[model samples]
Target: MAVTKTPIEDVAGDFHRPAEHDGVALWWLGQAGFLLRHNDLRLAVDPYLSDSLAEKYRGTPFPHRRIMAAPVAAGALTELDFVFCTHSHTDHMDPGTLPDMARASPRCRFVVPAAERMKAMERGVPPDRLILVAAGDVVVLSGNFSAAVVPAAHEERWQDGEGHDFFLGYKFRAGEKAVYHSGDCVPFDDLGDWLGVDSIDVALLPVNGRDARRKANGIPGNFHLLEAIALCRNAAIPLLLGHHFGMFDFNTIEVEAARSEIRSLGASSYAELIQPMTRYDIR
Candidate 1:
C-alpha cells in the first residue's frame, strides 16, 4: 500500500483548525517527535525536523539517514507556543531545528530537563525562554494546558547530584485529555506508577526495541511493540500511538511489517503504528 503523506503546506492550516474530538489533536513528526494542539495552545514534543543527524553520522556505522523527509520545517512553525526537549540528544533537542524554530516563534518557550539546561543552550535554546523541569515538577503551560514531568529510563535511569533526572518523559494535560510522550524509554518497573496511567488517554511510545549491538555502539533503545502494548494494557490507556521507527536505517525496525502486524491485531480502534504527518484526535 502506498503511504499518503499529509503535505507540508497543509500542516500550518491543520494545526489551526479545531479537532474533531473535544480533546487534543496530534501529529507525528517522525521518530519520537509529536506536534499537539488543544484549544488555543500549540506545542511540540521532541521534534526533529532537520537533517543534522544524517550529516553528522554520514559515514559512521549508524549513518543516521532518514527514510522519510521531514514533513514540516522548524521555521514553518511560526505559531508554535512551546517546544519540549525530553533530553539533549541531537534528534530530540536538535541544534539545527531549535535555533530556527526559536527565531521563527519568537514567543515560543522551550521545556527542557533541568539537568540538560547547559546542553539545551548549546543547542541554541535561549536561556530566557527555557522552562527547566525536574522529574517531580509540573509546569502549567496555560490555564488548561499543563505537563507533569516523569523519569524515563533510556535503557537505564540516571540523575545528577542535584537530584535532577538526566532523562525525562512528559504527561501533558490538555483540557480533559491526557497524553503521555515517553522519550526514548524502555519499560521500567515503576513506570506505570509514575505515569499515573489511569489518567492517560493516549500514549505516544517508541517501538524500536533495544539490542546489545546497538547499545554497545552507543545507540540506546526503547519499547518494542509488545512492551508498548503491555504498558498500555497495564496502564489502562485506551489509545497507543507507536513511533521511533522508520527514521534511521540502523536502529529502526522493519516498519512496514510492524505496521502490518499492528493492523492485523484487530485493535485498530485502540492501537496504531503511527504514520508520519498524520493527525490523530483523542476525545
Candidate 2:
C-alpha cells in the first residue's frame, strides 16, 4: 500500500540553528525527533526530516497534517556518537532519515530494542553498528554515559499468538542527570513498576496520547495529554517535554490548550511542559 503523505504544512522546511551548550540541553527537532547535547557527546533520537511524511498524507482528511518544519536537517546535525531508536515505528525508524544520518555521521552507533534488531538491520542500518538491548541491559555508551532499554506497550500491546510487534523506551543517564523517553505506550496496570526509577529530570512524552482507540490507519499512536500528565506526575518528574503535538494541523490538539492542561494538572510546581520550537537547558 502506498503510504499517505502528511499534509503540506507538516513538511514545510525550516531548520533551526543548533544551540551552544555548557552542560546538557535538549532541542525538539519536530514530531518525535530530538537532538540532545552534553559537552562532547551528542545523541539524536528518532530524528525525522520535515518532508518524510508530507507528500503521502497531503489529501488525507483523518491523519494530522505537519505544522512547522523539522527543527534541523540530517546533514545539518552531524558528528553523532549515538542514535537511539525506541522501535520500528516509522516515527523512530524512518527510512528516509536513517540512511542520510548513517552517511552523515559514520561514527555514530545505533542502540535499538533487541527485538527489532532484525527489522532495523533489514533497513540497511548495518549489522555491526547495531546494539540490541532490553530492560536490565545497561549499555555504557561512552565516558561515564549509559542507557537502559525498557519495554513499552506499543499500539499492539496485547497481541497474542505469532502476530505482534514490540516497542522500546529508553532511560538514559549521564552522571547524576537522567531522562526517559516513553516511546509510544499506554498506561499499564503496573506502570510505576515500569519506570523502575523514582524520578526523571526531563520526561519526553506524547501529549497526543494515542492508544488502541483510533481505528483509522496511519493514526499517531501516542499518549493522550492527560495520560502523559499522569505518567509524569506519578513518576514525580519536574519537567515534561511535549512531542507529537503539532506534527499535523487536524489531528493534534492546539498547542495552547495542550499546555494549559499540562499546567493545570497540579504538577506544574514540580513539572513543566514545553512547547515545540523551544529548548531547555538541563543542569
* TM-score of each model, in listed order: 0.93, 0.82
Model 2 per-residue lDDT tens digits across residues 1-283 = 0111112221112112343433456667766677776666778887777465565556666443456666556766567888888778666787768777788788888887766777888755878888877656778876766777666775545432433336767777767777788777767776578687645777888666663445365564767777777777788776666676666665466777765765676655544444555455666
Candidate 1 regions with alpha-carbon error over 4 angstroms: 1-9, 18-22, 263-266
What is candidate 1's TM-score against the reference? 0.93
| RMSD (Cα, Å) of model 1 | 3.3
**Among all candidates shown, the one with the greatest lDDT:** 1
Give the per-residue Cα lDDT of candidate 2 at 20.
48
Candidate 1 lDDT tens digits, 1-283: 0112343446767886765545777888888888988877889999899999989988988788888788887898888899998988899999989999899899999999999999999999999999999988989988978999999999999899898988999999977789999998999889988987347888899999999999999999999888898899889888888898888888788877877877787666677788755777666
What number of clashing residue pairs does each candidate have, in the order they appear?
A: 0, 13
lDDT minimum window of 10 residues, candidate 1: 1-10
lDDT on C-alpha atoms for all candidate structures: 0.86, 0.66
lDDT of 2 at 215: 38
